[model samples]
Target: MVDFNSTSFHPATFQLTGFPGQEAAHHWISIPFCVVYITAIVGNCTVLCIIWAERRLHQPMYLFLCMLSVNDLGMSLSTLPTVLGIFCFDVTDVAFDACLAQMFFIHSFSFMESGILLAMSFDRFVAICNPLRYAAILTNPRIVRIGLAVVIKSTSMLLPFPFLIKWLPICKGNVLSHPYCLHSDMMRLACADTTVNNIYGLFATLVTYGLDSVFIILSYVKILRTVFNIASYEQRLMALNTCVSHICAVLLFYVPIIAVAVMHRFGKSAPRLVQILLSYACLFVPPVLNPIVYSVKTKEIRKGISRIFSRDFL
Candidate 1:
């Protein structure tokens, strides 16, 4: 005999909480993020420019690197401006549509970055495992096709997320603890049952990011086995060195993601500041480190970067 419309036990709707009495802490956090954002933009832009300026660097690996740079740029641009606006100008008000748009691009670029990483892994596997067939298998036309597939596939997968959010009957607890509207955090605001959304989100994460990581690990394992079977110690060393940058990049990206997930599950009682800081850390750290890892670890890229700056100065 309970009337659904007459029920008084509605979901608790909390207002958007701004930074609470921590002006100094907020400023400190904002400064470092601004610095990191500048560094990421400059470093990734430099890498992309270097690859574009040098015709010799126009291989499949470099092409994927360029795509990664583009993805990183998109990721940074999607979240940083709003974060800076909030921290610096105290502008925490964001329209629902704008928030959804930011979330869409952030997830889209994240998925695309995962796809590009898988493509890079495939490139390395071919180059090291089957050198003779590398050129034949990863020709210009083939690379173009692969790139298009990456864009199309990532876009299709993430396109559903934002639309689903838009359709949700959100009952006014729109304040996201993190700077951006993350899938899980936004889903928490829905007044309707979110079981389907959670299931789909988990599935998307597993299929795209989780599966990509597994394949990359397998690729490296095979590469390692090949290296061990080779007679020349120098060749093994060289092969191992080639994979160093990729290994570092993967660790940097995934470790933070895992940390965020773990913290969300187990650290629910932790301070809100800790949760927000940790979540934002995961978003920004990988992009900041990616360009540095690639530049330091890849010799040709370093040389290309040098040539780019030298030309600019001339």
Candidate 2:
């Protein structure tokens, strides 16, 4: 029988030669990322404050929106600090345990965000499809329940990831290619055979992200159908407009994810820099863009944000 914790197993290893001698580009990238990180924090914080203060915005839809803002804040916070640390201080050597922890949170928050998006889609579906039942279906108690479920489900699904890494005997390679430890990337460093890990990873991805995406698409499809069957052209237009921002947000988050997945699978021997850049963009861009899309498209949020700023300055 193979001992799981045996130290005799040789670790699979790789090194991230920092930016391939282009330290200048690495420094330059930090400036834009820093600006985006600050903006995302401010924007998400404003959303949260407004949602908290305003009684009118306390419904299920807005509740989900607030949760989404919180998730985005978490997603940004998980990665940006480490990224900035790498760029500013050249402190890239992360301990093995720290890397596993980072990977766990990154994956957990990512799944949480996906769950929030699914919840938002359900909110919109009810609002459009069964307007009369909307309030009853989405009461304060129910919303709270769903929120708890999101947290519980996301946390449960990703809990095994870090623990799995911790149990493995890491015999080689401490340097990660990216600023944060990505699950797949980290798995490559394990000395043990990763067939089980890969299978479980794919399962998690399919169930959480993949299933949520399918449900979101179906919700929008029904929403679009309902809108088209409406008698009023203005109503159809308004419904379509409401969905535009959501569609854009989904695309922004998922397109880069798909791109990175494809690159990882098919772009074997692709330059290390390309892989790192793709991963970095996937992590940072969606959080930066989510608040912008919502604020620009949702008048209530925009006005609420404006009021928040005005009151703060005055």
Candidate 3:
């Protein structure tokens, strides 16, 4: 065993432990992961293309959706290479710099997705709670600004993590918990001081996930109140119906993340495979399911998709 206490210890490469204790089943695992990745890419890309080509989808709601599809695409692509490499090629070694870059992209996109979801919630709130001013409030230029702001905010918040990771002395054998790199997982390998890393990670989590979730809930609360005040029951139902797809999107994105956190905190005795699967669920399920949920629940998107297929057939 290498001396972790050495002052000059720094690993050049990190070995990814993909589904530990399941080496024999890696090939079988790759098949499902491959399918999920492909589906996510195709689904999100289809959503993006339909939104772009359909004139009617130029509205604020769909514009936000276009942002979401883009975020999901980024998230999927960030994890795709290493994940496939581990399961398919049996390549588990990732260069230190490359691992840090992967961690940055994966974490950045995860936070970006939260910001996008928060923005989507705001869009729904305005459209339902204040329909008359929806267009005025969520103007095209303003929407672009919102998109840029979310990207900048999420990216900026995570920008420090890579540098922080580099500052630490990694000496715990450089074995990663998942096929992908994460700030927490990387920090754990540090044989030196990690208090700063720990504190900052918690702070980043709160500012992104915590604040965004609070605002999203607040937006929906106001939305629900506005819907309830509508004189006609049908109108109230219709208004609520508009949020069904977004609500599903939010659940898909947050539930797995929450489960992973809870599992890590409370279920330490949980099987490694189970924890890894939950982590996979956190990263993989949302991208793969978001487009399907939206396509089924949102009429305009469905119509847009149908129109494309119908045109191709004609």
Top candidate (lDDT): 3
Ranking by TM-score: 3, 2, 1
lDDT of each: 0.80, 0.79, 0.91
Across residues 41-65, which tens digit of lDDT does each residue of candidate 3 receive? 9999999998898887899999999
Model 3 lDDT, residue 205, Cα: 96
How many steric overlaps are in each model, in order?
Answer: 0, 0, 0
Report the C-alpha lDDT of model 2 over 1-314, residue by residue, as the tens digit. 22123453423332333465766677786788789889989888878888898899898878988888888898888886577877776666665556667788888888888888888889888988888999999999989899899999998999888766666555545556677778777677677778878888999999998999999999999998999899999988987786676788788778888988899789968988788778877777778888888899988888988887798899
Q: What is the C-alpha lDDT profile of model 1 across 1-314, one tens digit per residue?
A: 21112233322232233356675676676787789889989989988988888899998889888988988998999987677876677666666667778878888888888888889889889989998998899999999898899889888888888878766777645566665667777778778888778888898899998999999999988998888999999989998898888788778778878887898789889888777667766778778999999999999998987777798899
Against the hidden reference, what TM-scores do the models get? 0.90, 0.90, 0.96
Query: lDDT of model 1 at residue 156?
Result: 88
Strongest candidate by TM-score: 3
Off by over 4 Å in 3: 1-8
RMSD per model, one decimal: 4.4, 3.7, 1.8
